[model samples]
Target: MKSSIKDVVGEMVTPFLEENHMELVDVEYVKEGSNWFLRVYVDKEGGIDIEDCGRVSEFLSAQLDERDPIPSAYFLEVSSPGAERPLKKPRDYERAVGKHVLVTVYEPVDGLKEFEGTLTSYDETGLAVAIGQKTYRIPADKVASARLAIVF
Candidate 1:
């Protein structure tokens, strides 16, 4: 059910993102408390501003109205993914190389499930994270999720 919604939303919103020379970071449909939220994350080379979010929200709203794809009432939101933006696809990971990142593994690596450090390298096989003095090579499949972490 959730996958279907994501696919539908991705399909509906992708053209808009591309037309605007923006990238679709992610789309999520989830229930929190008594309400459901359909959150859209978009970005570009220089990063996105509030105005970009507003435009995407307006355009997506119109598309949703015309398609009427979702039967349930869900609040629509469009925004930047923020400091800890998730790496949803291969390109995202590639772009995130040389940046600080936080990654959680599907299983423990070196007795640790979480890793936070600079992303030194990434390829089809795995990612190399420089944690402190040591570098750890984590298989791409072992990662549960990864995101660019804001360094203070």
Candidate 2:
């Protein structure tokens, strides 16, 4: 159900995003307590502001009203992913190169699943992160999750 929602939202939102020079960062549908929330995360070269979110929300609200793809009631939220956003796709990982990042592996690598440091490199094969004086080369397949990290 959530997958279908994400897919539908992704398709319906793309044109609107492109027209506004925004990028779709993520789509999430989750149940919190008694309510269901549908979140759309968007970004651009410059950071997104409240106005951008409001505009996207207004556009998406109209589209959802027109299509009525969702059968159940849900809250729609459109916002920026923020500075410490996730590195979900290959392009995301690629862009994070030379930036600080946090990575979690599926299984322990060097007896640790979590690591944070500078992303020296990321390619089709693997990722190299410099943790202090040591550099660890992590195969991309072993990564459970990766995100830009706040150095502080």
Candidate 3:
């Protein structure tokens, strides 16, 4: 059900993003307590502002109202993914090269499931992350989740 909502929301928002020169980061449909939230994350080359979010929210809200694809009531939220944005796509990984990141794999890579460090390289095969002095080669297929990491 959540996947279906995400799919429908993605379909409804793609054109809006393209038309507005924004990139769709992600779509999440999740329940929090007794409420359901449909979150739309968007970004562009320079990042997005609140006004951008508002525009997307307005457009999406109208579309959702018209289509009524969701059976239950849900709050719609459109916003930027922020500095620690998720790295979900190949392009995202490519762009994240040389940046700090946190990557988790389904299975252990070198006996470790989580690696946090600088993303040294990314390619068709996989990505290389340098954690301190040690560099680990993590297969793309093995990755369960990845996101930019803020170095404190």
Would you estimate the TM-scores of all the predictions? 0.96, 0.95, 0.97
> What is the clash count for each candidate, in the order shown?
0, 0, 0
Candidate with top lDDT is 3
Per-residue lDDT of 21-79 in model 3, one digit per residue for the tens?
99899999999999999999999989999999999999999999999999998888899
Worst 10 residues of 2 by lDDT: 87-96
Model 1 ranges with Cα > 4 A deviation: none
Q: In model 1, state the lDDT of residue 19.
A: 92
Model 1: residue 102 alpha-carbon error in angstroms = 0.5
Would you list the clashing residue pairs of candidate 1? none
Number of clashing pairs, model 2?
A: 0
Query: What is the lDDT of every predicted structure here?
Result: 0.93, 0.93, 0.94
Q: In candidate 2, what are the lDDT values of residues 1-152, reduced to their tens digit?
A: 78998999999999999998999999999999999999999998878999999999999999999999998899999998988999988889988899999999999888889999999998988899999999999998899989999977
Clashing pairs in 2: none
**128 Cα displacement, candidate 3 (Å):** 1.0
Write one digit per residue (lDDT tens) for candidate 1, span 96-131: 999999999999988889999999999989899999
Residue 73 in model 3: lDDT: 88
RMSD (Å) of each candidate, 1 decimal: 0.9, 1.1, 0.9
